[model samples]
Target: MKATQELHNLGQSLWLDNITRGLLTDGTLARYINELVVTGLTSNPTIFDQAIRTTAFYDDDIRKKTAAGKSTEDIFFELAIDDLTKAAELFRPDYDATGGVDGVVSLEVSPLLADDADGTIHAAEKLHAQANCPNLLIKIPGTAAGVPAIEETIFAGVPVNVTLLFSCEQYLAAAEAYLRGIERRINAGLDPHINSVASLFVSRWDHAIGDKVPAELRNRLGIAVAQRTYKAYCELYDSPRWSKLAAAGARPQRLLWASTGTKDPNAPDTLYVQALAAADTINTIPEKTLLAFADHGKVSSTLPADGGDAEKVLAAFRAAGIDDQALAAQLQLEGAESFNKSWHALMQCIVEKGQSKSTGTQAEQL
Candidate 1:
């Protein structure tokens, strides 16, 4: 059996960290769903930017929207929603079979709103309404501003994928935001089963400390961080607070391992995927990583819920002068900035594409 199937059977979800119109039109996404066990997908400004800039699939739509006097951002959203809605439909079977637990496709809110809580909340709501797919998750960063937005969005009955979290503490913050939202729903006599996921980035932790840490610690920090976070996740759900909510039909916001693609060339391609495997969690992996894992990956054991050796590994890093809390803050800030940069670049790409199309038409007429 393919390792992907094995992982799925082991109770971990495999979500593609990509979305492109070609994948949907060519049935590639569906093929992955059937053969590789990819239950869902996730997208961001970077992914969309790459998709729009590199492919001609969206050009006709871009030209149409440009002619309709749509703003760059508006045109981009129109294209994104169109693509994501289609992908959501393709995954609808898994979604239904799993009772809204597995199949999900995520679209992030404007990174420019990373620091604007109200704007983020509004954008999430608008996008969710516009997409109108129950399997779609509007992604919000786990930034301080975004935490409140997450709560408000969830309380308003929109599912969320809390992104950009780095450390266990950051994961906890996002989890708390989700729980608060669910608690508010219960208080208001609303259904507490709103879906959510707190995405903790994995590979970036190792990438950030790669050069700083010793050779033995290379490519190990991220998995250790996940281990620590997973323990916390299991503990939180086991608590009476979560138990009470669960009794009331509240679903635990799952712990998702994001950025699972190995960044270090010397590291094994399946390093993060193999190390972070656990039941009741999601791992959104890059296409390359997914293929690589399907080719040669092996899942020997699932991650220990009690966080085996996580403390010891973390202690070794601390002894090596890695400040966990400070670095987590830095990584989250850097991640938001990176996405903001991609968002601007994407808008610019749209503007240029629209202009080039108009120019081509004028030349043809001449």
Candidate 2:
């Protein structure tokens, strides 16, 4: 059996951290679903920017939207919603079979609204309604501003993928936001089963501190951080607060591992995949990592629910002068900035393509 199938059977979800027109049109995504056990997908500005810039697949759609006088941002969403909706449909079977736990596709709100709570909430609602897919998750960063937006969006009945979280504390905050939203729903006599996931980024932790940490600590920090968070996640679900909600038919907001792709070339390609395996959680991995794992990945054991050795590992890092809390804040800030950069690049790509298409048409007429 493929390693992907084994991981799926072990109760961990493997979601593709990519979406592209080529993958969907050529059945690559479908093949992953059938053979590699990729039950879901996640998208971001970076992924969309790369997809639209590197392929001619979106040119005709861009031309149509541009002709209709759509703004670049609006055009981008129209393009994104089309792809995500289609991908959501493809995964609808898994979604139905799992009761909305596994098969999910995520689209992020504008990074431009990363600091605008009201704007984030409004955009999330608009996008959710526009996509019109039940399994869709609108990604809101776990930034301070995004926290309130998350609560409002969830209270309003839209599912969310809380992104850009780095530390266990950030995860907890996002979880709290989700809980507050659910609690408000229960108070208002609404269904408390609204779906959500708190995405904790993994590899970037190691990447950021790789050069600063000692040789033995290289590529180990990310997993240790994940282990710590997983322990917290298990504890959170076991608490009375969560139990009360669970009894009321609410699902625990799942812990999702993002940026699972190994960043260090010297480390094993499946380092994060092998280390972070746990039931009731999702790991959104890059396409390269997914195929690499399918080829030869091994899962010896799932992560400890109690966070085995996580404290010890973290202490050693602290001894080595790594300030976990401070670094987490830095990483989150850097992540938002990185996404903002990608968003701008995507807009430029669209503008350039639209202009070049118009120029070609004019030249032809001449």
Candidate 3:
């Protein structure tokens, strides 16, 4: 069996961290679902930005919406929603089979609103309502501002994918926000089974610290952080606090590994994917990473439920003068800034394309 399937058999979900209109129209997304064991997908400002700029797949929709005088943001969401809705439909079977735990697709709100809690909450609600798919998750960052929005959005009963988390601390905070929302729902006599996942990013840690750490420690920080976070996740779910909520029908917020693609060329392409294969967790991979794993990846031991050796590995990093907590905060800030840049670039691309279309000149040259 392919290592992807092996990982799936070990009870981890392998999700694709990409989506494009061409992937959908050309049946590539569906093929991934069938052949690659990809049970879910995720999209953000950056992915959509690239998809829109490089393909004529959305040109007709852009032309129609431009003619209708819709703003660039409006056109962007319209195009995004259409694509995600279709992708959501393709995953509906896995969603139903897993009882809403495994099959899901995530769409993030404007990263530009990362600092605006109210605006993020509003966008999440709008996106979820428009999506109209039970398996669709409205992704919100786990920033200080986004935490409250996440809690309130969950209380309002929208499934959320908490994104851009960089540390166990950030993951725990996001998980707590999800729990608080569920707890409030139970207090208010509402269903406690609203689904959510806290996505802790993996590869970026190694990328950020690769040069800082010794050569022997290269490409190891991300997996160690993930192992530590997984340990926390298991402990949280087993605690009395969570047992009470579970008794009330609340689902434990699953931990998702984002940015799992390897950034270091010297490391195996499937380094993160192979190392972080823990049951009940999710690994969201880029398409190339997914294929690489399926081709030559090896799955050996599952991550220890008790977070074995994670602390020891972390201590080594600490001895090297690396403070994981402080770095997590910095990475989260940088991620938000990167997303904001991508969001702005996407909007500008659409505006320029709209202008060119209006002027009878194609956006292809510019």
Candidate 4:
């Protein structure tokens, strides 16, 4: 079996992190689902920005929405919603088979709302309803401003994929928000089975500190941080509080490994993917990384439930004068800034394309 299937057999979900209109229209996404066992996917402004900038696939819809006098953001969301709802239909079978625990696709709200809790909440709720796909998750950042929004969004019955998490603390914060949301639902007589995933970013840690650390320490920080967070995740889902919630039909929020694409040229392409293989977790990898793993990757070993050498590895970094705590804060801030940049770029791309310039009827099937 391919390593992707093997990983899935070990109970890990592999989701493609790239989505383009071509992938959907060209049958490539379907091929990945059937052949590579990719159960779900997640998209961000960056991905959409590239997709819009690089292809004419969206020109027809852009022109129609633009002609209707919709704003750039409105056009973007309509296009995004249409794409995601179609993708959701494709994954409906896996969603049903797994009982909503897998086969989910995520779309993030505007990065402009990251600092506005109320805006984030409203966007999440609105996006969820607009898409109206049970397998679709509306992403909200895990920032302090986004935590409460996450809870309220969940209480509103929208599935969430928590983005921009860089540390165990961030993951725990998001998980707490999910728990509170579920608890509130139980208290209010709402269903407690809303699905959510706490996404912990992986490679940005190494990319940020790769040159600051020793050669041997390069490409290791991300995995160690993931191991530590996984320990917390295992413990949280197994705790008495969670057991009580589970009895009330609340699902444990799954831990997701985001940004698993390797950044160091010298490091193995599958470095983060192979290292972070744990059951009941999700690994969302870029398409390049996914194919590399399916070609030559190994399961290696499942992550240690007790965190194995996570603490020891972390202590080594501290001894090297790299404070993981401070850096976690820095990375989270930077991640938000990065998303903001991409969001604006995407809006600009839409503005330029949505102008009345004709593209010859936009071809068929786009």
- Name the best candidate (by TM-score): 4
Q: TM-score per candidate, in order?
A: 0.97, 0.97, 0.97, 0.98
lDDT of 3 at 7: 86
Instruction: Encode model 2's per-residue lDDT on 1-366: one tens digit a residue.
Output: 998998898999999999998899889999999999999999999999999998788887798888889999999999999999999999999999999987999999999999999999999999999988999999999999999999999999999999999999999999999999999999999999999999999999999987898888888888999999999999999999998999999998999999999999999999999998899999999999999999999989999999999899999999999999999999999999999999999999998877765444422433
Task: Give the poorly placed runs of model 1, Cα more than 4 Å off.
Answer: 358-366
RMSD of each: 2.6, 2.7, 2.1, 1.4
Q: Which should have the higher TM-score, number 2 or number 3?
A: 2
lDDT of 1 by residue, 9-86 (tens): 999999999999989998999999999999999999999999999878887778888988999999999899999999
For residue 263, model 3's alpha carbon misses the true position, in angstroms, by: 0.6
Better of 3 and 4 by TM-score: 4
- Candidate 2 C-alpha error for residue 361, in Å: 14
- Per-residue error for 343 in candidate 2, Å, reads 0.3
lDDT, residue 315, candidate 4 = 96
- Provide the overall lDDT of each model, using Cα atoms, as 2-decimal numbers: 0.93, 0.93, 0.91, 0.93
Question: Candidate 1: lDDT of 139?
Answer: 96
Better of 1 and 3 by lDDT: 1
**Best-fitting candidate, scored by lDDT:** 2
Residue 271 displacement in candidate 4 (angstroms): 0.7
Q: Pairs clashing in candidate 4?
A: none
